[model samples]
Target: MSNIKSSKKHAIQSKKNNQFNKSRKSLLRTLIKKVDIAIIQKNKILAQESWKILQPILDRFATKKIIHKNKASRCKSRLYLKIKKIP
Candidate 1:
Protein backbone atom coordinates (compact mmCIF):
# COMPACT_ATOMS: atom_id res chain seq x y z
CA MET A 1 0.00 0.00 0.00
CA SER A 2 2.83 2.39 0.81
CA ASN A 3 4.32 3.70 -2.44
CA ILE A 4 7.60 5.07 -1.08
CA LYS A 5 10.25 2.62 0.22
CA SER A 6 10.66 4.58 3.48
CA SER A 7 6.90 4.51 3.95
CA LYS A 8 6.87 0.74 3.64
CA LYS A 9 9.65 0.46 6.20
CA HIS A 10 7.73 2.70 8.54
CA ALA A 11 4.64 0.58 8.18
CA ILE A 12 6.58 -2.57 9.05
CA GLN A 13 8.14 -0.90 12.05
CA SER A 14 4.77 0.35 13.22
CA LYS A 15 3.28 -3.14 12.98
CA LYS A 16 6.16 -4.55 15.00
CA ASN A 17 5.79 -1.90 17.67
CA ASN A 18 2.06 -2.48 17.82
CA GLN A 19 2.49 -6.21 18.44
CA PHE A 20 5.19 -5.63 21.04
CA ASN A 21 3.07 -3.14 22.95
CA LYS A 22 0.07 -5.48 22.75
CA SER A 23 2.01 -8.35 24.31
CA ARG A 24 3.46 -6.12 27.02
CA LYS A 25 0.04 -4.81 27.97
CA SER A 26 -1.36 -8.33 27.99
CA LEU A 27 1.40 -9.49 30.32
CA LEU A 28 0.70 -6.55 32.61
CA ARG A 29 -2.98 -7.44 32.74
CA THR A 30 -2.20 -11.09 33.44
CA LEU A 31 0.06 -10.21 36.34
CA ILE A 32 -2.53 -7.88 37.77
CA LYS A 33 -5.12 -10.62 37.49
CA LYS A 34 -2.85 -13.02 39.31
CA VAL A 35 -2.59 -10.59 42.19
CA ASP A 36 -6.32 -10.03 42.21
CA ILE A 37 -7.02 -13.74 42.19
CA ALA A 38 -4.68 -14.21 45.11
CA ILE A 39 -6.51 -11.51 46.99
CA ILE A 40 -9.84 -13.11 46.19
CA GLN A 41 -8.52 -16.37 47.52
CA LYS A 42 -7.44 -14.61 50.73
CA ASN A 43 -3.87 -15.75 50.20
CA LYS A 44 -1.75 -12.94 51.55
CA ILE A 45 1.58 -14.55 50.81
CA LEU A 46 0.65 -15.26 47.21
CA ALA A 47 -0.73 -11.78 46.75
CA GLN A 48 2.42 -10.25 48.16
CA GLU A 49 4.61 -12.37 45.94
CA SER A 50 2.66 -11.44 42.83
CA TRP A 51 2.72 -7.81 43.88
CA LYS A 52 6.46 -7.99 44.20
CA ILE A 53 6.63 -9.22 40.63
CA LEU A 54 4.10 -6.72 39.31
CA GLN A 55 5.19 -3.50 41.01
CA PRO A 56 8.43 -3.07 39.12
CA ILE A 57 6.82 -4.04 35.83
CA LEU A 58 4.24 -1.32 36.31
CA ASP A 59 6.94 1.21 37.07
CA ARG A 60 8.95 0.05 34.10
CA PHE A 61 5.98 0.31 31.76
CA ALA A 62 5.33 3.79 33.01
CA THR A 63 8.96 4.68 32.55
CA LYS A 64 8.79 3.38 28.99
CA LYS A 65 5.67 5.53 28.38
CA ILE A 66 3.66 2.39 27.53
CA ILE A 67 1.33 3.35 30.35
CA HIS A 68 0.72 6.61 32.16
CA LYS A 69 2.55 7.20 35.44
CA ASN A 70 -0.65 8.07 37.25
CA LYS A 71 -2.30 4.88 36.07
CA ALA A 72 0.60 2.83 37.31
CA SER A 73 0.53 4.53 40.69
CA ARG A 74 -3.21 4.17 40.94
CA CYS A 75 -3.17 0.46 40.18
CA LYS A 76 -0.37 -0.09 42.66
CA SER A 77 -2.22 1.84 45.33
CA ARG A 78 -5.55 0.12 44.84
CA LEU A 79 -4.08 -3.35 44.63
CA TYR A 80 -1.91 -2.76 47.68
CA LEU A 81 -4.88 -1.58 49.67
CA LYS A 82 -6.87 -4.63 48.66
CA ILE A 83 -4.01 -6.94 49.58
CA LYS A 84 -3.59 -5.18 52.89
CA LYS A 85 -7.29 -5.46 53.66
CA ILE A 86 -7.15 -9.21 53.27
CA PRO A 87 -7.09 -10.73 56.74
Candidate 2:
Protein backbone atom coordinates (compact mmCIF):
# COMPACT_ATOMS: atom_id res chain seq x y z
CA MET A 1 0.00 0.00 0.00
CA SER A 2 1.22 3.45 -0.93
CA ASN A 3 1.09 6.12 1.77
CA ILE A 4 1.41 9.18 -0.46
CA LYS A 5 -1.32 10.16 -2.95
CA SER A 6 1.14 10.46 -5.81
CA SER A 7 2.55 7.06 -4.98
CA LYS A 8 -0.91 5.52 -5.13
CA LYS A 9 -1.52 7.09 -8.52
CA HIS A 10 1.83 5.81 -9.74
CA ALA A 11 0.90 2.32 -8.57
CA ILE A 12 -2.37 2.43 -10.50
CA GLN A 13 -0.64 3.69 -13.63
CA SER A 14 2.01 1.03 -13.32
CA LYS A 15 -0.63 -1.69 -13.18
CA LYS A 16 -2.27 -0.36 -16.33
CA ASN A 17 1.05 -0.19 -18.14
CA ASN A 18 1.88 -3.72 -17.04
CA GLN A 19 -1.36 -5.08 -18.46
CA PHE A 20 -0.83 -3.26 -21.75
CA ASN A 21 2.72 -4.56 -22.09
CA LYS A 22 1.63 -8.10 -21.27
CA SER A 23 -1.06 -8.06 -23.92
CA ARG A 24 1.34 -6.73 -26.52
CA LYS A 25 3.83 -9.45 -25.67
CA SER A 26 1.13 -12.09 -25.85
CA LEU A 27 0.03 -10.88 -29.24
CA LEU A 28 3.62 -10.94 -30.47
CA ARG A 29 4.01 -14.52 -29.27
CA THR A 30 0.77 -15.56 -30.95
CA LEU A 31 1.89 -14.05 -34.23
CA ILE A 32 5.21 -15.82 -34.08
CA LYS A 33 3.54 -19.09 -33.23
CA LYS A 34 1.20 -18.79 -36.17
CA VAL A 35 4.16 -18.47 -38.49
CA ASP A 36 5.89 -21.38 -36.81
CA ILE A 37 2.86 -23.59 -37.15
CA ALA A 38 2.52 -22.71 -40.78
CA ILE A 39 6.14 -23.59 -41.34
CA ILE A 40 5.75 -26.88 -39.51
CA GLN A 41 2.77 -27.73 -41.64
CA LYS A 42 4.92 -27.02 -44.68
CA ASN A 43 2.54 -24.46 -46.05
CA LYS A 44 4.93 -22.24 -47.89
CA ILE A 45 2.43 -19.63 -49.04
CA LEU A 46 0.79 -19.38 -45.66
CA ALA A 47 4.12 -19.15 -43.90
CA GLN A 48 5.22 -16.42 -46.27
CA GLU A 49 2.04 -14.48 -45.63
CA SER A 50 2.34 -14.84 -41.88
CA TRP A 51 5.99 -13.82 -42.03
CA LYS A 52 5.04 -10.69 -43.96
CA ILE A 53 2.53 -9.73 -41.28
CA LEU A 54 4.95 -10.54 -38.46
CA GLN A 55 7.91 -8.47 -39.64
CA PRO A 56 6.36 -5.08 -39.02
CA ILE A 57 4.87 -6.16 -35.70
CA LEU A 58 8.35 -7.19 -34.60
CA ASP A 59 9.76 -3.87 -35.76
CA ARG A 60 7.11 -1.90 -33.89
CA PHE A 61 7.72 -3.80 -30.65
CA ALA A 62 11.44 -3.30 -31.07
CA THR A 63 10.96 0.42 -31.65
CA LYS A 64 8.80 0.68 -28.54
CA LYS A 65 11.48 -1.23 -26.59
CA ILE A 66 9.01 -3.94 -25.74
CA ILE A 67 11.61 -6.37 -27.08
CA HIS A 68 15.25 -5.82 -27.85
CA LYS A 69 16.19 -4.76 -31.39
CA ASN A 70 18.68 -7.61 -31.71
CA LYS A 71 16.07 -10.11 -30.57
CA ALA A 72 13.62 -8.87 -33.11
CA SER A 73 16.23 -9.01 -35.87
CA ARG A 74 17.23 -12.48 -34.82
CA CYS A 75 13.63 -13.70 -34.84
CA LYS A 76 13.12 -12.18 -38.28
CA SER A 77 16.27 -13.82 -39.55
CA ARG A 78 15.34 -17.24 -38.20
CA LEU A 79 11.84 -17.02 -39.60
CA TYR A 80 13.23 -15.92 -42.95
CA LEU A 81 15.56 -18.87 -43.01
CA LYS A 82 12.73 -21.26 -42.20
CA ILE A 83 10.62 -19.79 -44.96
CA LYS A 84 13.50 -20.10 -47.39
CA LYS A 85 13.89 -23.75 -46.54
CA ILE A 86 10.18 -24.40 -47.06
CA PRO A 87 10.65 -25.64 -50.59
Candidate 3:
Protein backbone atom coordinates (compact mmCIF):
# COMPACT_ATOMS: atom_id res chain seq x y z
CA MET A 1 0.00 0.00 0.00
CA SER A 2 1.65 3.19 -1.23
CA ASN A 3 0.92 6.22 0.89
CA ILE A 4 1.46 8.79 -1.83
CA LYS A 5 -0.58 8.94 -5.06
CA SER A 6 2.62 9.04 -7.08
CA SER A 7 3.85 5.92 -5.38
CA LYS A 8 0.59 4.20 -6.19
CA LYS A 9 0.99 5.12 -9.84
CA HIS A 10 4.58 3.87 -9.76
CA ALA A 11 3.41 0.57 -8.34
CA ILE A 12 0.86 0.17 -11.14
CA GLN A 13 3.52 0.90 -13.71
CA SER A 14 5.84 -1.60 -12.10
CA LYS A 15 3.19 -4.30 -12.32
CA LYS A 16 2.62 -3.62 -16.01
CA ASN A 17 6.34 -3.77 -16.70
CA ASN A 18 6.56 -7.03 -14.84
CA GLN A 19 3.87 -8.55 -17.01
CA PHE A 20 5.59 -7.41 -20.18
CA ASN A 21 8.93 -8.73 -18.97
CA LYS A 22 7.37 -12.08 -18.12
CA SER A 23 5.88 -12.43 -21.58
CA ARG A 24 9.21 -11.66 -23.16
CA LYS A 25 10.88 -14.16 -20.88
CA SER A 26 8.35 -16.80 -21.85
CA LEU A 27 8.96 -16.15 -25.52
CA LEU A 28 12.72 -16.43 -25.01
CA ARG A 29 12.35 -19.76 -23.29
CA THR A 30 10.08 -21.04 -26.02
CA LEU A 31 12.62 -20.08 -28.64
CA ILE A 32 15.37 -21.76 -26.68
CA LYS A 33 13.27 -24.90 -26.45
CA LYS A 34 12.86 -24.97 -30.19
CA VAL A 35 16.62 -24.94 -30.58
CA ASP A 36 17.11 -27.54 -27.92
CA ILE A 37 14.58 -29.87 -29.51
CA ALA A 38 16.27 -29.52 -32.84
CA ILE A 39 19.61 -30.33 -31.25
CA ILE A 40 18.24 -33.33 -29.44
CA GLN A 41 16.83 -34.68 -32.69
CA LYS A 42 20.39 -34.49 -34.00
CA ASN A 43 19.40 -32.52 -37.03
CA LYS A 44 22.32 -30.23 -37.59
CA ILE A 45 20.59 -28.33 -40.37
CA LEU A 46 17.43 -27.88 -38.35
CA ALA A 47 19.37 -26.74 -35.33
CA GLN A 48 21.29 -24.26 -37.42
CA GLU A 49 18.07 -23.04 -38.96
CA SER A 50 16.40 -22.70 -35.60
CA TRP A 51 19.35 -20.76 -34.28
CA LYS A 52 18.91 -18.21 -37.05
CA ILE A 53 15.29 -17.76 -36.05
CA LEU A 54 16.07 -17.67 -32.34
CA GLN A 55 18.79 -15.06 -32.71
CA PRO A 56 16.46 -12.22 -33.65
CA ILE A 57 14.03 -13.03 -30.85
CA LEU A 58 16.95 -13.01 -28.44
CA ASP A 59 18.26 -9.70 -29.77
CA ARG A 60 14.86 -8.07 -29.43
CA PHE A 61 14.48 -9.40 -25.90
CA ALA A 62 17.90 -8.07 -25.02
CA THR A 63 17.16 -4.69 -26.62
CA LYS A 64 13.92 -4.40 -24.64
CA LYS A 65 16.02 -4.92 -21.47
CA ILE A 66 14.13 -8.06 -20.55
CA ILE A 67 17.44 -9.95 -20.49
CA HIS A 68 21.14 -9.06 -20.20
CA LYS A 69 23.11 -8.74 -23.43
CA ASN A 70 25.89 -10.94 -22.11
CA LYS A 71 23.33 -13.58 -21.21
CA ALA A 72 22.07 -13.55 -24.76
CA SER A 73 25.65 -13.68 -26.02
CA ARG A 74 26.40 -16.69 -23.87
CA CYS A 75 23.27 -18.52 -25.03
CA LYS A 76 23.95 -17.83 -28.68
CA SER A 77 27.59 -18.84 -28.25
CA ARG A 78 26.69 -22.15 -26.70
CA LEU A 79 24.09 -22.92 -29.38
CA TYR A 80 26.62 -22.13 -32.11
CA LEU A 81 29.16 -24.39 -30.50
CA LYS A 82 26.69 -27.25 -30.22
CA ILE A 83 25.50 -26.90 -33.77
CA LYS A 84 29.06 -26.71 -35.06
CA LYS A 85 30.24 -29.66 -33.06
CA ILE A 86 27.58 -31.84 -34.67
CA PRO A 87 28.94 -34.26 -37.21
lDDT of the candidates, in the order given: 0.98, 0.96, 0.90
Scored against the true structure, residue 13 in model 1 reaches a CA lDDT of: 95
How does candidate 1 fare on TM-score?
0.93
Candidate 2 ranges beyond 4 A from true positions: none
lDDT, model 2: 0.96
lDDT digits (tens) for residues 1-87 of candidate 3: 879999999999999999989988998899889989888888998898889999998888788778999999999999988888888
Number of colliding residue pairs in model 2: 0
Q: Write the per-residue lDDT of candidate 1 for residues 6-50, one digit (tens) a residue.
A: 999999999999999999999999999999999999999999999
Q: Lowest summed-lDDT stretch of 10 residues in model 2? A: 78-87
The lDDT of model 3 is 0.90
Q: Candidate 3: deviation at residue 74, Å?
A: 0.3
Compared with the true structure, what per-residue lDDT tens digits does model 2 show for residues 15-86?
Answer: 999999999999999999999999999999999999999999999999999899999999999999999998
Q: How many angstroms is residue 63 displaced in model 3 relative to the true structure, after the best TM-score fit?
A: 1.8
Number of backbone-clashing residue pairs for each candidate, in the order shown:
0, 0, 0
Q: Tell me, by lDDT, which candidate is best.
A: 1
* TM-scores, all models, native as reference: 0.93, 0.92, 0.92
Please report how far candidate 2 places residue 41 from its true position, in Å: 1.1
**Given candidate 2, what's the lDDT at residue 61?**
95
lDDT (C-alpha) at residue 81 in model 3? 89
* lDDT of residue 46 for candidate 1: 100
